[model samples]
Target: MASKMTSGDLDEQFLTCPLCMLHFRDPRVLPCLHTFCRECLQEWATKQQPLECPTCRTQVSLPDQGVDGLKTNFYVNNLLDFVAVKKGAGPGVPCQVCEGGQDGDKSWCVDCAAWMCDLCTTVHRKLPGTKEHEVVPAEVLKAEKDVSKFQRKRHCHKHKNQELVFYCESCNALVCTACTVVDHRPGNDHNPVEVSGIADDKKDKLRQLLSHVDPRLKEMQDALKEFDKETMKLDSSRIESVNQATSYFQHLADLLQKREREILSQIDATYRGIGRTLESQKEAVESGFSRLASARTFCRQAVDYENEMHIVEIGEQAQRTVEGLLLERVNLKPEQDKVQFSERVSVTDFKNDVERLGVVSSTVNVDVSKCRVVTKTPVVGLECTSVLETADEEGQAVAVSREAVSACLTGPKGNTAVPTQLRAKDEGRVWEILYTPEVTGRHRLEVMVKDRDVTGSPFDVVVRSRESAVITIGSEGNEEGQLKKPLDVAIDGDGNVVVLEQVNRRVQVFDAGRGNVLKCFPIDNDGLFGTGTDSNGNLFVTSFGESYGIRKYSQEGELLATFNPEYLRHPLGVAVLQDGRMVAADKQQKSCLLLQPDGSLIREIGKGQLQDPWFIAVDQSRGLMFVTDNRAHKVVVFDLEGNLKFSFGKRGPNRGELNGPTGVTLDPAGNVIVANKADGRVQVFGPDGTYLRTVTTTRGAPHGLALTPDGYVAVACYTGHCVELYRYK
Candidate 1:
């Protein structure tokens, strides 16, 4: 049966079952839209109680009837029928209608799904029931191009003999004419419409879905192309690095080879010179020994056998020869024979240099996650910096060229400003961005590498005017002008100083310039934490002891109102917005609360991120709120909508590091001035959270701080219990 169809006829694998590895038998489609043989799914369902689609691993929810209840894949069934028909059209197929089951002609009964002989085919066509069935010859059926044209009419499952002709829109099912009258009665609950009409409506909806999906598919294809391009670039970079390393080591190897030859030649020349000196000394010693032996022989002969005169003469000659041989200085020791190997240069130093030779690096790209803004807040005339770091996939810092990095600043109304300078540091691993803003407002700074935004790019920068410390307000004492454990301070619209005292529960109103008590108001609350003044110059004090709430007071020491928000526990610092809303930092809750004008809960800011939230300051011009997290030792910035913008400072004693930050306020130029209670110093930062400078280092712990209208900063010292006013403009 397989030999009748060529491999080019169709892909047999598509029609093959993945589980049984054979032709599909009664294919059943799962909810995931994957189809498998009914028996195969039934067998699988037994082993895996909660079955998942084998192809996609999606969990399947089968009908109560199990695998047999799954929807039949009619499309796959039609294709299988088409293939079978094409195969059966060949000769040698057994006849279905003939009694003897003789070999049939190349004719098929589409309705009966069988082959028939010539005589049987004629007899089948004459019968009334079989006459309407499609009895096409194998050659004609094989010539049909479209598989969909071979679709057969389906019958209702309950009514075996009835064809399904109606589609129930309500139930989203197909039904027969009899089913429409019974189970699918034409009503609101069972609207059984003609299949043709409903199918047209479904096809239109499908077309609309396709229109939306096509654009997304195109975008995905483009992204894949981008990935391919990146892969190619990596390949090119690797090849270039390999070439460079090879050339460098090759040059070093050549130099070492040349040095080896020179040293070896020097040793050989020195050895030969020492050899000549030893040879000459050996010859002189041998000659001296031969002369001495000859003289001794003559003296012995004269003494033993020769006449007395000969003996006497030979004795003197022998004596002279012996004496001369001893005095002739014939050296028996080796001369210049030591040719030891001694290093002219230190090998240890050379080895160290070799160890420190060129580093092998991979192609590092700009890592958006590692890039950040160095200067959070920028001044109108001063430069601010944003640092961009490049790294490999493993996050190891690696070099990237300065030319690859670019920075742009956009202010209100989309005014674009370019970076003043781009400088590379840390061997090109870090790029510093410098930009100066021309106006004081909220601006966005975007740092990019290769036209891609770095992580945390497009940072919001609030530029303000530059300010400095000018004066010191009060001294330590309990007198009229003196304060004791002053916890919070605020400046009213009338330029009057309102100081909240922890020891006496006194809210003192003082002259902004002379620091003299104008009107001293006594609060009954024992746990006064912070003081704030609204636009109408009305004072608002945050307190928490027996009862926790914010109290509004008139300038003349009369309590106006009290707001007790349910979520505001342990209110420490409070700031009033121009719209009558209040923001309070709660120490116990470790978060900030935004309250409506009537102290209704608006939202919580930095809920889980903050620890020991102490003070609040609002930058209404940029719609930002700055909170000092004392224990966290950082200032967290949030938008009016409670979205976290950024945070700056860490726990340390350095210039930019904050140690127990408290009493946060904005200077006239919008710079964040935070008092460090632990370090006894007040530090200033740009609007973007970059540490700008220190305002003043107090001898006492500074708590609540506020900016006076006349360019002065009023900081309440908790230990000294006095308000110190500094020049801040």
Candidate 2:
């Protein structure tokens, strides 16, 4: 029956399906919290394997049964039922059960989902099937405003007559009593329990999720408002710049008429660029805010109105949605370039140099494409130089003050290093930039002048940590000299390649230049993964499985001590900092632990940021640590205190993409060398996490990698079962 919505009731837009643009029919909610008709979603899902929500276009991982497996929007259903009863389907609604004439007052059958006349209601009561059904007088139901009190008991779609009495915990589905005995019988795959028994716990979990999402919603709202303010500021700045140019040009109107037009045009062009950037940023903020708000509302609705089974079905998707939102870094400040008109002329100067009277300059005037790096490759701890020749709008080099030019070097974990000198030459047109990097890795050199970025402000710079290896080492074998499943590699202070074998359960030391095996020691355990060395020639190894711990050893293969921190589970990679502290990456815990030299836990790093932390490398000189998260497909960098500086990489086969990164090591210059197990490639990045280049693609999957003192990268290949050295300078 059709129902009329009043002004006081829920908005029609909320009840209307996005796909059909009609009142929702069996409304179903997506993980992204957008609602649509079940049939509409089912039809849409048929077009794609991983369904994208028609409203938001979010990728949705549909349940095994597809759209039909989606949980019902009980809140919307209840509202629809309430609105139907309140409006009486537009006066004298005929009894649906009897299909009678519109003559007598009707009573609403909550269970049968129909309207009945008084005579029909009496007959319905007399019928054995409808004896316990709730039949309320239409007038009385219309007066009721509490929608929760009108919640209908859900029934299994397979057995329409039987109510859903059991919730299958394993499959997270609701089933009728008869269906539970057949499909959801007590087994490993299907654990069915009473709906009432699991309700409280599910509700509590959903409530907790709501509480977590509420703060993020507020954050998104605040960020949206901030972007709005920035938009206003951008407009104000644009107007101010135009006015400044107008006022100055008016005084010299007759003498600088043509110049005035050119300057104002430059200002307009810059404003348009900045405006577009600001608008894009604002749109992103608004989108994030809207997504979070909708998801938050859905979480609250599910907890308050949905049945236990429905809650369980949506729990995983909801958790993923919330977790993904939390990981998104909100841009609190506007990043658009500032628009301003600078007067490069005085009255006397303008008269003398009319053609060059007033040059319009901005951060965008540097012409990044025209700028060149004088140094081909920057080596860590060494002086590097890049030349920037400031240009006019036409790309002609023009003179500008040193203060107008700025160069910033950014590294992994968001660490920023500044150039030592920005010497202006060639009549202040050509800038000679000089800087020394302490750590090696992928870094960006952002050159800006007059507050705006050059065309390509942030230039990719890969700082080499070490030169390529001059030799190779190790071969696959079960013998003492042969390597088997070489999972991790480290360079001792004496420049020896220390390899950890996973299957052989041995730490084999080999000479740097040759493949000769120097010494070997049994690990006496399985799941050995990572290895590292300190300046004192001591070695540290991490292992999991049966014997999981961080083991310390001397250069002579003597076990010094073993540390099994109570909280450290599945330690994968280990590194010893200059200060005698230890850092270990725990794959199972999804974090890196900082410990004292004596094996006491100091603190955890990248706690919630890493998904599968496998290996770690450190630049103690700069107080930075780099971690390779295998599952996350990124290298997360953190400061000494565990504060995330930044992270880079993603899942792809492209140049910079990291697919299941396994081993990470830093060169003397802080260049980060990483081995990707999935792709079998070893990539080099600057300290800032910028992918420099792929050193080499191995025939087998690459694991633990290390940079030797003599300028060689020793990579332990698990599948190849060998340590291959590559020259990396």
Assess each prediction's global lDDT (C-alpha) against the native.
0.69, 0.77
Which segments of model 1 are wrong by more than 4 Å?
Answer: 1-472
Residue by residue across 456-565, what tens digits does model 1's lDDT show?
A: 77877777654422234556666666677899988877888888888787788888755667888788987888888888888999889776899999888799999986
Give a tens-digit lDDT track for model 2, residues 1-729.
113333375677767887888999999878787889999998998888677888667799887887787777777887777777766645766777777747778888888667788889899999877787888886687666656656676777887678888888787677889987898889888898888888767667667777777777777677767667766786678778878888888878698999988887867766555555456656766777777778877767667664565666566667678667767655545654565676777876688777765555444334444444443355676676677777654466756666777888877545676556887776677888888877777788887766656666677777764333335566778997788888889888878889999999889889876678889988887788888888798888888887899888888878999998788889888888877789998878788899998888889888789888888888888989988888889999999898999989999999989899988888887888888999888998888888888888887688888887756788898888888887665
User: Each model's TM-score, in the order given?
Assistant: 0.36, 0.47
Q: Give me the candidate number with maximum TM-score.
A: 2
Worst 10 residues of 2 by lDDT: 1-10
* Per-structure clash totals for the candidates: 16, 27
Query: CA lDDT of 435 in candidate 2?
Result: 82
